[model samples]
Target: MEFVERYNGSGLLIEVEKILYEFKGVQHIQIFQTKSFGKMLVLDGKIQLTEKDESFYHEMLVHPAMLMHENPEKVLVIGGGDGGAVREVLKHDPKEVVMVEIDENVVKACKEYIGIDRGALEDPRVKVLFEDGLEFVKSCKDKFDVIIVDGTDPNPISQALISSEFYRDCAKICDYFVTQSQSPFAQPDYFKSIYKNARFKNKAVYLGFVPTYPHGLWSYLIASDRREIVLDLNVIKERFENRKIETVYYTPEVHISAFALPRWIVNLIS
Candidate 1:
């Protein structure tokens, strides 16, 4: 029995039932099990997701942007090696889902261990590419209806994902964009930096709470070139009925509420 503490000292620790996997490639990756959070995925000492509440994180990360896109036929998922975002994207019945994961180990480990990713990678519409997401975006010519960046924390390995140039490249290729921005309470500067650098016609910040992550507050940024996010419950409900989409967390009401932020946090972004 052992305890793993988050890097930022959030005072939340997980008691490990056992170590399922560990590797040190681009960064340290560890998959373990806990009594509270169930199966845990940790990267660089940062808790990424837990099986118990993964639906909350994954649903929040993918659905808001997905629903806003009138027709999300083609989708791109960068750095979601665990396939949680891919699973959510497939719910929209996209024609294609291109997943670019920098580390292959994460995909391999999660495929065997993470329930959220089960059967997600094997879907006919999903094409997995093992490469650097930044380089892949730079050289790619195809455009997508939506792009979701389910990347790790902004460490050296993921620095390019947050760059102004990278966001510009993303804007050029996709109509709708979404990414897992860190918790505002923990990394306020980084959170503000993303909003500052993302050059999009329409943008909004939304949040979801996952107990396993730092600060228990997970933030996602949604950007678009053509569409303003539809916050109306009636419209969102209509879309859900049309698609017959089922999710554990995201709903029409939650979508509207997620964008409503605290005054202090809104001030930081503004």
Candidate 2:
């Protein structure tokens, strides 16, 4: 079988050996086995993560904000049903991580098949809540050092995650907020909407490469209540060294350079 992603006159097809799992619940979920990327998880026909290069997406999403914070003892992750973002956040030895996933079926599917989480779902420090992310953020009383929005693309149902109302609630509860902003190249409308709506005290859009994602590139928006969205390179390097965190794709240099967007992308934000 072949798994194909087609949109906007572009597509990616992967040769699949088997369909490991299929289900329809709050959202359609499918798992495919491919010799190249290992098992791939597709949620609502969009490639969420593949076993091989998921680090490129997850590490980029979780770490820059995690490291930018002086000490992220408490982290709140929204919509990371697969647990990949949670796994990366655990390396920081946070005191607690509150993971709010909307679909429990997605959580169960990834736990049994995807394996990207690597047991992050079962960590004692993690508290998994099955609820709508936007609603949860609005009702949450506890503050966090970092908040990671790991939701899906900017579709109609998921637009609330990237909305101004959501960012306002986030700003009240967290010092640093990071979110996947879709691919600036392949889905310019979605990315532009997110950047334009994010009216934080300070914000920056960082770059990363996710092969299976649209346009083979992805972007993330990091915002802070402080005047700075990112710390200095020297400070970042020093903090990263002190943490002694092991990562497959994230580095102090990468964290600093990711903010150096192309002129056009910068123009979109400005």
Candidate 3:
């Protein structure tokens, strides 16, 4: 019956029906009901996702790299405990999806209160592993067609994932790797670190809108040493039509346009 607010600079406040779950383990985690956004998930006092516009973030994070490849059969998802990233990956009908999440509590809380995941975690094609993502990437022997990192911001806990060491290992194992790179406008320096530290031969950054996150705009990076990810617009469009997937935000045009960086981002990354 009260409102919880996320304190950044100006911050965001949401009226909650009730706090469904809240705990302090490794980090603080909470899930609560909201009227406009449906249910919301918070991690370490940061708003992770709200039910209303999560599709924008999830679709953009998943589809661009996925379509960049011809047929991505084997995929890896790291740290998206809410399962939104996993759900998007399922649309392509990949042979297998290996998900490694650092926090099991986040998954459990999202599973119970927030249904944004739309039940993709239980899909037979997915294998869920609760472990440290950086360690998992270092040790994984299997090569994947695509690797998507849906982790938190680059803090001490997530710094290793955005580190050059992790990026090198990921490049060696996967044909393509994509990860959240923070908002281009809000955390430009941090975003630059994550985007630049990858050091891959062929890397590209894309932009999307995530209303619940800081600045209402977010950026993501796709990195690979295999070859340039650029494909013809027609080819991307054909893939979209052939897959017959229903998406809320990302389309072939949007996929092509995501790489059309804003001038500010162009300057930031340059």
Scored by TM-score, the top model is 2
lDDT of each: 0.87, 0.90, 0.87
The lDDT leader among the candidates is: 2
RMSD of 2: 1.0
lDDT of 3 by residue, 97-155 (tens): 99999888888888887867789998999999989988988988999999999988776
* Separate clash counts for every candidate: 0, 0, 0
Estimate, for each residue in 1-270, the C-alpha lDDT of model 2 and write its tens digit: 888999799899999999999999888899999979999999889999999999999999999998888999999999999999999999999999999988899999999988788899899999999998999989989999999999997666577998999998998999899999998888888899998888898988999988999878899999987637755889888877888888888898899888888998987766
Q: In model 2, where do residues sit more than 4 Å from their true spots? A: none
Q: List the residue pairs that clash in candidate 1.
A: none
How many backbone clashes are present in model 2? Answer: 0
Worst 10 residues of 3 by lDDT: 2-11
- Whole-model alpha-carbon lDDT for candidate 1: 0.87
Q: How close to the true structure is residue 114 of candidate 2, measured as C-alpha lDDT? A: 82
